[model samples]
Target: MVVFGKELYKIKSDRYKKARGGWSRIIKLHCVECGEYLFDYQKDGAGILKRLYFDRIFKELPKKPLKCKCGQLLGIPIIYKKEERPAIRLFSGVVKK
Candidate 1:
């Protein structure tokens, strides 16, 4: 696990390629309420992060409703209907890039 700031993240080393836009950047997700580091994410396209794919998360996360250490609600675990992939639906203004 790679330590960043005060948090530990298990970096994902496997490379993933998309038919469309490839992996763009790796961004550190932070808690909005406390500004604490949440996790590292491999974001594909630009713009707001509405959902976080499980495979893109670089750290192990708790099951079900994912929350920050400060108890602030971040996202809910769900299967994205369109892609049929497991992902976390992030709440608005709960997290920052």
Candidate 2:
């Protein structure tokens, strides 16, 4: 799927925080056709900052029945990955624990 302007902005902001030694917050979605995973970032605050930004675009997404490769409605899993680590260990370990 092609990402639009607003989606790109969200990704850039998430990357900037990671560059500044902040935790990376990932939001994962799945493709109904191929069972492929699409990973995005959660836009909430880093740790407890008193207030939080909880208005995520995904929250507005409508949950229509997902179609499988065989054209059947099947439920899929949405994973969230959020954590911090060294460069090599970033993708190595669990993002959420």
Candidate 3:
């Protein structure tokens, strides 16, 4: 759930190892509104909505309204609004349990 963009934000880089290559960058974009996870791994870039961007196709997403196929309306609910942190962080040692 680590949302990355302008800051070179680090999630579990150890977890996202195969997330390499130009335009082949794999990412899991979480929807704050629908509570779903989307991917940027497919070769077909248009498979997911660009408004969701995944930090690749679009620079920002707060203004974008998402229409999930499941009929959930969501988007980058935290972007352009506040500095929100991921609900969970792995290996970075935020876990206390």
Candidate 4:
């Protein structure tokens, strides 16, 4: 299936499985600069996407400093202190949901 102008790949996510009690949605992530498909992500809750946890990612990505094929620096990997987990801190306005 295709969604958001990209092919969709449905994958099960265990991130926050217990905490959210299955309250999550899979979203198609794209690069704002070139409109390139980044990856399919499992997102929780509702609001602007601040960051992406490593475990919630459906596709494997390069280590740290995530970038799109168009050369846009999308995000940088960091340890989310509040959640005490590994995550990618997204650059504001660099990505499209």
RMSD, one per candidate, in order: 3.8, 11.5, 13.5, 3.4
TM per model? Answer: 0.78, 0.23, 0.24, 0.79
| Highest-scoring model, TM-score | 4
The digit string of per-residue lDDT tens for model 4 on 24-43 reads 77787899999997888878
Candidate 1 lDDT score relative to the true structure = 0.79
Q: How far is candidate 1 from the true structure (C-alpha RMSD, Å)?
A: 3.8
Candidate 4, clashing residue pairs?
none
> lDDT score of model 3?
0.33
* lDDT-superior candidate, 2 or 4: 4
The alpha-carbon deviation from the true structure for residue 87 of candidate 2, after best TM-score superposition, in angstroms, is 32
Residue pairs clashing, model 3: none
What is the clash count for each candidate, in the order shown? 0, 0, 0, 0
Candidates 3 and 4: which is better by lDDT?
Answer: 4
Q: Each candidate: what lDDT?
A: 0.79, 0.36, 0.33, 0.79
Off by over 4 Å in 1: 1-20
Better of 1 and 3 by lDDT: 1
Model 2 has an lDDT value of 0.36
Question: Any idea how many clashes model 1 has?
Answer: 0
